[model samples]
Target: MSTTTSETGARVVPIPPPLYYAAALVGGVLLDRVFPLAAAHPALRVAGLVIACAGAGSAAAGVLAVIRHRTTIVPHRPVATLITTGVYRVSRNPMYLGLALLVPGLGLLIGTWWPLVLLPLTLLAVTRLVIAPEERYLRQRFPDEYDAYRARVRRWL
Candidate 1:
């Protein structure tokens, strides 16, 4: 899957991280139908909304930063720029972080427990399947700049 684009062509991952999150959401929804594990508490539902909103805000900030820098947003395409401003200052993987928050937040909003349970596995897959390769590509492409940025920013916050 990592060979979807090409090492020289675009440095794309085999499967995009968003698909992992989306699959988790769908799987969780299906599992909830069978298991019926609800979020239970109203407070948890409220928290879910807040967390989901924060996740959205984080992802959007990252997107806006990319747009401001005129960089490519698709992970399956070449990264024309190495962004280190806006949300990138706080977390190198803000969009991924947002998905992390969003899935479980949505699970809670929908009164299901399966998505939260599935999150860790999804993140693990993403880290290995998507982020690691992207980081390697960035390191290869940007060298000193990426190293400095990697040192300055956390991967997830």
Candidate 2:
């Protein structure tokens, strides 16, 4: 069953957690470009590249998971098929996790330590405002099957 927005009757849109993470990442990038704090350190540059690569890798893995499941990765209305293999086995919200990873990577790339530190708060907000509710809905919608999957896998990995 599809979800709907109350007033508009539009399908309830689940905001992907990556959006916020990406926003933060972009912001961090801009800040770094404008501020240029990490440019002086060769080690920091290497670290930033590593972090950025890791973030890209995580996002790619999530995308592969979505394709493998043959499901829409939209946060609000997940596909009817329940995915339990590949990256889904590790994290119920790998896309979110990947985005989570991405923010800090961007921050590192930008040499903004504060933004990197803020990444956890961003994840917490997405989890509380979006992911948790989605989990509750999925629980109600799929019941036993979702519960089994939930039991076996972590919400974030």
Candidate 3:
């Protein structure tokens, strides 16, 4: 399924989260490769690895929650239920948050400043191009339940 603006008929980006993560990872790698920088301290590299692992864990938890709830994990697909437990209790967009966290973690691991610089831009793109549309759809579909959930949980933690 595709997302489109009713008023302008403009197409909303339907890029999947994995693709976004890949793009950000590739962009950061390329930037670092072209302009090599001093490697981060070993401690920092370890910290980055931990953060990346945490992100992957979080994303997995989110997916598991969705599965347990019998809902589609695909953002563009129809949501079967409003999930508010587990990771969803803390962050409305844990998967997106996970992907966002990976940027800095990977950057730090690679000892490149470029990924840190591009983090905000990557987040902005995900927020505007992906999360916003999903939020709109969820609000429309779940209405009251979603409103309550939104009130209780932060978008990202």
Candidate 4:
């Protein structure tokens, strides 16, 4: 979903995180096609697959936790609850963290360096374009509760 202003229902997250990650993955793969930087070993590629799976699992767990709580998963949307259980207990932004990990893993799995190379930019974009705004909204909306949660949980782990 697109970001909305404070006056509208949802507010401040500039873009959906999935879109950022997807673009990174696709762009990186395309860059790999042009640059041709293949992984050096077969084991590394396998490792990438494992990492990708783990990332997928983590992201899925986060999504499930949100669904179980019956809250909106959309970053821009107004949150109904402060999710501090399940996947959220470990990281405040598990879904983003998962996708962040996933993009690089996919790059390695594909035997290329571009995704890993592009990962930093992906993170920068996600943090600035999505997470930062969402955090602002959360802190503004939940104040004391969000502060407590932030105090205890790491942003990413």
Candidate 5:
């Protein structure tokens, strides 16, 4: 999807990330269902809440940034603007970063330690599969401009 509104007449939709995010959440939920995490250890309840809240905050920041930019955050879709200001300055892929953070938060909240393993995997998937391809596309689409911006900013800060 080219960001040039003229190239793609239809409005861009937010592209969902890879299957692992959903898979991680579902697996976490299922594990919690079978074992029921916080029933025995009340202390974990507090920790879970904090982690989930942090995730929510990160996700909210990404969503707000997207809304402010008035474009899709998904890299596969064409980006109307580069959006180097604000949150974009900190992390090139905040939405994916936020969602990556969210998976562990969910696992933490559910008290399912096993599913938390997917946290690193989520980052790897986003970096290698999702973000890498999108970066290449962006570079091709916006060569010099994107390269200059990339030099200044980190991909996953």
Candidate 6:
């Protein structure tokens, strides 16, 4: 799916990252609730909470960087500038990475193994369905800058 913009032309990403996260969260919860796993140890739950908080922090930092640069946060919209600062410096797709982190973290928090098992599926979907297209758009839109950034930073860290 694609969305057209009169300004930047058309956007390749149809479903946004948030929606994907939401779906994964709901699916994981339902799976865990139905299947039921042994509850996670208290220590594990604490670790998961910490990890989830870190992921959320990373995502927020990325968004703040984009906002600071005054760029469009919407995936489909044309980017005003390439953000290479803050958490972005560490991961090319920090927001996506954060969302990816969230899955297993949430699973651990809920004391279920299902979400952890399903974590890779969410990453796969986001990588192929979302990040790939965004990378293509960035490459086309800001070839030199994006190429440099991509060469320097890992896709997810």
Error of 1 at 42 (Å): 0.8
lDDT per residue for candidate 3 within 31-146, as digits (tens), equals: 77888754579987987898888888788888889889987777767777889999998999888788777777887798876776777778888888878888888777777988
Output the TM-score of candidate 6.
0.90
Give the total clashing residue pairs for model 6.
Answer: 0
Error of 6 at 35 (Å): 1.1
List the candidate numbers ranked by lDDT, top first: 1, 4, 6, 3, 2, 5
Q: Report lDDT (Cα) of residue 131, candidate 1.
A: 85
Q: Write the per-residue lDDT of candidate 4 for residues 33-113, one digit (tens) a residue.
A: 788888869998888988899899889999999899888888766677889998899999989889988998898888887
Task: List where candidate 3 sits over 4 angstroms from the true fold.
Answer: 1-12
* Model 3: how far residue 85 lies from native, Å: 0.3
- Give the alpha carbon lDDT tens digit for every residue of 22-128 in model 2: 66666666766676545336676677778777767767887887787676666565465667777778888777777776666666665676567567778777878
Provide the global lDDT of candidate 5 against the true structure: 0.66
| Model 6: per-residue Cα lDDT at residue 49 | 91
Q: Which stretches of candidate 1 lie over 4 Å from their true place?
A: 1-12
Expressed as tens digits, the lDDT of each residue in 1-157 for candidate 5 is 4355324322222445746577777876786778664333566556666766766676678778778888765554566766777767777776676676677666766667645765676667666667777777677667788798899888867
Q: Candidate 3: how large is its RMSD?
A: 4.1
lDDT (C-alpha) at residue 40 in model 1 = 81
Worst lDDT run of 10 residues, candidate 4, spans 3-12
TM-scores of the candidates in the order shown = 0.91, 0.76, 0.88, 0.90, 0.74, 0.90
- Alpha-carbon RMSD, candidate 6: 3.1
> What range of 10 consecutive residues in model 5 has the weakest lDDT sum?
5-14
User: CA shift at 59, candidate 3, in angstroms?
Assistant: 0.6
Q: Which stretches of candidate 2 lie over 4 Å from their true place?
A: 1-16, 29-40
What is the total number of backbone clashes in candidate 4? 0
Shift of residue 132 alpha carbon in model 1, Å: 0.3
Assess each prediction's global lDDT (C-alpha) against the native.
0.85, 0.69, 0.78, 0.83, 0.66, 0.79
Model 1, position 7: C-alpha lDDT score: 40
